[model samples]
Target: MTYMVLLAASFGYVFLKAWQQRNVAFDHVWWVLPTSYAMAVVEVIVVTKIVMTGGNWLAVFVLGTGGGFGALTAMWFHKTFLTRRE
Candidate 1:
């Protein structure tokens, strides 16, 4: 499925970035943004698919929004706190 491919790509990106930037302590965190955003998009797509298949739309919306926000918050924290400290 498209989701699987996207997930794999994100993983690959993370892996390559980590490998290439192994000397930098905060480099992994920077590379995480792409994976995190891809995951959020995947969550939205999955939720939409479930809703279209007769699942609860409200639940889907709630979960998708929460996941997206959570990922963004995590990225923000990593940038603001973790990266800044190093």
Candidate 2:
């Protein structure tokens, strides 16, 4: 369950941050920092809870793996959706 949350938070964090960067690059008014901060807070709190509760470090590893996938997916999405055609 916590792993699921971690996965989701990581995915959302990367997706939103990447989306924001795409928008910003185009001179859009969308601000990504506040929402990205919220996502970071979620990650921090979840990790803290896991550590404080003595949860398995394996789960943390899984979370990190999820985050890596999330970042990759976000990059792929940006390249796919934000690109313009001639």
Please report how far candidate 1 places residue 42 from its true position, in Å. Answer: 18
Q: What would the per-residue lDDT of candidate 2 be over residues 1-86, giving only the tens digit for each residue?
A: 66677667666666666666775785545445675676677667566656754777766676677667777886787678665656
Lowest-sum lDDT 10-residue window in model 1: 14-23
Candidate 1, 1-86: lDDT as tens digits: 43444344334334333333441555665555565666566556655555454655554454445445544555555566555452
Which parts of model 2 are misplaced by more than 4 Å? Answer: 31-56
Residue pairs with clashing backbones, model 1: none
TM-score of 2: 0.57
TM per prediction: 0.36, 0.57
> C-alpha displacement of 46 in model 2, angstroms?
4.3
| Whole-model lDDT per candidate | 0.49, 0.66
**Positional deviation of 5 in candidate 1, in angstroms?**
30
